[model samples]
Target: MRKIYNSYINNFTGLSKEIWLLSLVTFVNRAGAMVIPFLSLYLVNDRCFSMPDVGWIMTSYGLGSLTGTWIGGRLTDKIGFYKVITLSLFFGGLGFIGLQWLDSFAGFCIGIFTLILIADAYRPAIYVASDVYSKPENKTRSIALIRLAINLGFSIGPLIGGMIIASIDYSSLFWIDGISCVIASIGLFVLLKPKEKDKIDPDSSIKKEGLPPLLNKLYILLFIIMVLTSITFVQYFSVMPLYWAKEHFLSEDLIGWLMFVNGAIIVIFEMPLVGYLERINISKTMATFWGGVFIALSFIVINITSWSGVLIIGMLLLTLGEMIGSPFSSALALEMAPKGRKGSYMGLFSMSFSISHIFGHNGGMNLADTYGFDTTWWIMVGVLIIVSILTIWLYKLLKKSPTFEGT
Candidate 1:
């Protein structure tokens, strides 16, 4: 037992204090992530919004996320990540406070859009901080640590949120979430020191020495694959809850517990899983391919069976995929970026997932509402297969590059 405990500690030994604190901040922020997970339910049940209305509002949030990440990257490069992260957290908390007052459709739309724009901007800044704080060999582990913190908090959030909604009201959710964000912002501000901003001017032409991230063909292919995978993966939040509640006849508490299970699995396994993947010399592309495949299988299993016991099996598969894919994808983005452009690369990568939210939530909801849940699941399976193929192609293409030797 001592040997195993020591080995576990050894696995996480090399990361910096900044990374640890950043992980803590991530935990605090995500622990309050009750809003997004329950947003669709709130809109449909509480606000009495139509499915289309829900889709549009979610799309608006996605658009805000897309815009926020892009602009945040530029700001992080120009002004420094410290300012960007702190400001994003502080103001994002205020946005949530504002959201509690808005009751109409337009007000809700505008409120959600503004809130996401400020809140999601923190993503790239955090990624940049993760990269800046850790050594190259520990990069993947560092990213995993951050994700572990996020999932740990996520596990807590929805469970507590379930109780909150059950006993209190949605207004309490916003207040709690908002307060959490502000506290996280204060923690970050007190802990993280200011660093020199990236020197490259955003408006200037790309130096002849290296291609800009936007023009890099390999990176673009990776981004496309991310979009495809996220489209399928996002259904867990967007439609799965609705399906469980409406179709499976699960209660709100039960649905929250299911979501908690997803997070709990990731928190338990993600770090060791990344360590094992790295030790085995698994390529990021291959990990991603298998992850995509597992995600598809998760939904396929759901399509084939309705047993509640089987649902845990499916959720396990989905969580396993997330454990494999998410951190390595971030590591790959950092590995591929030019010096001084990590923020931009991370931003663009963040945007890929954000962009998918637009299509995933809107498209998935539309299909489920119109065609049925099974149709949506089948479509997800088809999309994941294509994404897996693309990942394979990406792997082969990377094998030819000079950097490929190290990757």
Candidate 2:
């Protein structure tokens, strides 16, 4: 056991103090966030709100995220990452606590807006900090490790929330979630003190090459690729279960476990696979991985009639694709960023998912409802193919672009 542990520790090179701290912060932040998937349920079972009403309130949260992501990205560049992360935790905690007093739909909406806005605001801060703290060689692994922490928290948080909800009232879910956020906030507050003063001035550090004149350049192209892929990504949570429940005849609990399986696989396999994948070029690997994902995702479209076997196989492929795509996306974003604005680059990357959620959820639901789950699944697969092609093309464009040089 000791030998295995030592070997594992030895494999980690260039693991910085800041990365470790950021990972811990991510873990804590995600633990609090896991409560959100259950928020709709709490509104229905506890708050006496209708499903449609709860959905509108949830929409407010998405709006908050849209605004918060942009605001957070700017704030990370201006104020500093540590402060933004601190506020994220503080607001997240406050939002959870506010749920205690929530009675009407409007009250719930207000609380959700506050929680989502603040909670989302901190994300870009964390991403920028992680990117800044990292060197190029280990950047992919570092980001993967950070994601692993978030996934770890995701793995455990839901289980704990389920236990709490089963044993206690829905109110306890919010109370515990609030406390977790507070504790997470305190951890970040104490540990992640800014070292900006120790570093060179931002302007002196790396002079900014003012905005790239054309918005239709490589960076923008990459953003579009991500958005396309995210159509399938967001479906994992939003409509997949609904489709499974209605058509595949899967139980909600089973769907949850499948998601749990996805998370668990990522946490287990992500780090070990990092080195092997790093040996390949980022663009090629991304294309290949996403291609594989699309092919596997195609399996989901076939009507297997049995939910268990087919769902598991398709979801497993989806998870594998996710494991490949996520870290690669982060690394690619960092590579594409201009100097002194890693935060802004990462912030835009983060928005891909947020935007997808807003559209993908509503869109996928509408497609599934109007057409069928198979049609929706096939459409997403087609989108994934577009994403892969665009990613490869963008990689070529980025290689040729003059802006590749960091000013």
Candidate 3:
């Protein structure tokens, strides 16, 4: 028993104090982000917006996210990550709470767009921060550790947010979310003292000949895969809440627990699994392929049975895929980037997710609102199959390079 405990804890070693501290800050920041997981619920239940209107508001969210990542990524490279993260968190938090005042469809569309643009800037900036803090040998594990904090935050947030909704009102979610973000911003200011300048080797750090990610054919294909994969994944937070309530008849708190379960599994197992995969020298893309396949199966499993226990089973498979797939996808993006262009690479990569939010939220809601829940799950399964096929193409395309297998 003691040996097992030591081995489990050992998986998390070899990271810098900054990554851990950043992880703490990320935890608080994302916990406040609980407001997002419940955004559909608020619009549908409290605000009484129709499905199409909610879809438009969410579409604005994706547009904002796309622009924000573009700006944040560029700014992190120019001004520095500390400034980007600090400013994004502080202002974005205020914007989230300020959203309580908006009512009309156009107002929500514009408001969510602006707020998400500011909020999502924090995404790619944190990716760059992870790169700056980690050593090459343990980079994937380092990212997994940061996600460890994020998943832990996600786990706690939904459970509490559920209880709050059950007892009080949705407005309370906005207040707590905003306050926690402000606290996280203050923590960032105190804990992560910035360097004189971002340290990079001058020789390697000079801009490479190809500054454009679109110019690289392999990368463009990879971007397509990421965008598709994210569309299927985005449905989890966007439409699943409605699916659970309207279809399965779950209460607010139960739906929260289900989401909490997804985060909990990732928090407990992702780091150790990443460590084990690295030690065994598995191909990163190969792991990602399996991850996509597992997630695809997760959606299929939902349609397999009417039992509530099926949700638990499906959640486990989904978590397994997420743990295996997400870090490697991130590490692969980092690996492909030239030394000086890490910010730009991550920005484009993060934009893939933003694009997914645009398609995923609006599309999933439209289908659910029109057809029913089962059709949406089946369609998501089909989309994920395309992601899996793209991953295979990327895997084969990289074989000519010596580092293809490792990357």
Q: How accurate is candidate 3 locally (lDDT)?
A: 0.87
TM-score of model 3 vs. true structure: 0.97
In the range 1-407, model 1's lDDT, one tens digit per residue, is 99977766776889999899999988998899887788888899899998878888888888889889988888877676778888998899888877878779888878887888898889888888888788889999999999999999999999888888888888888988888899999999888766533322322224433567789999999999999999888888778888888878877778789889989988877887898889999898788888888899899998897776777888999998889889888898888888667778889999998898888899998999899999999999999989988998899899889876445
What lDDT is obtained when candidate 2 is compared to the true structure?
0.69
Where does the lowest 10-residue lDDT sum fall in candidate 2? Answer: 196-205
Q: Where in model 2 is the C-alpha error above 4 Å?
A: 1-11, 40-58, 100-110, 198-206, 210-216, 246-253, 282-303, 402-407
Task: Write down the TM-score for model 2.
Answer: 0.87
Ranking by lDDT: 3, 1, 2
Q: Which candidate is the best by TM-score?
A: 3
- Give one digit per residue, the lDDT tens place, for model 2 in 1-407: 99966655644667788898888977876775546656655665677775456546766666677678878988887777778888888777878877778788787777766777788887787777776677767887888889898888877676666566666666776777788788888898788776654361242266665563125366677777776777667666656656565666754355556667777887887776665567654463354346446444644535545545777777677777777777777777777676776667767877776676666656776776678777777788777767767766665665666766320
Best candidate according to lDDT: 3
**Which parts of model 3 are misplaced by more than 4 Å?**
198-205, 209-211, 403-405
What's the TM-score of each model vs. the native? Answer: 0.96, 0.87, 0.97
lDDT of 2 at 387: 71
Kindly indicate the candidate among 1 and 3 with the higher TM-score: 3
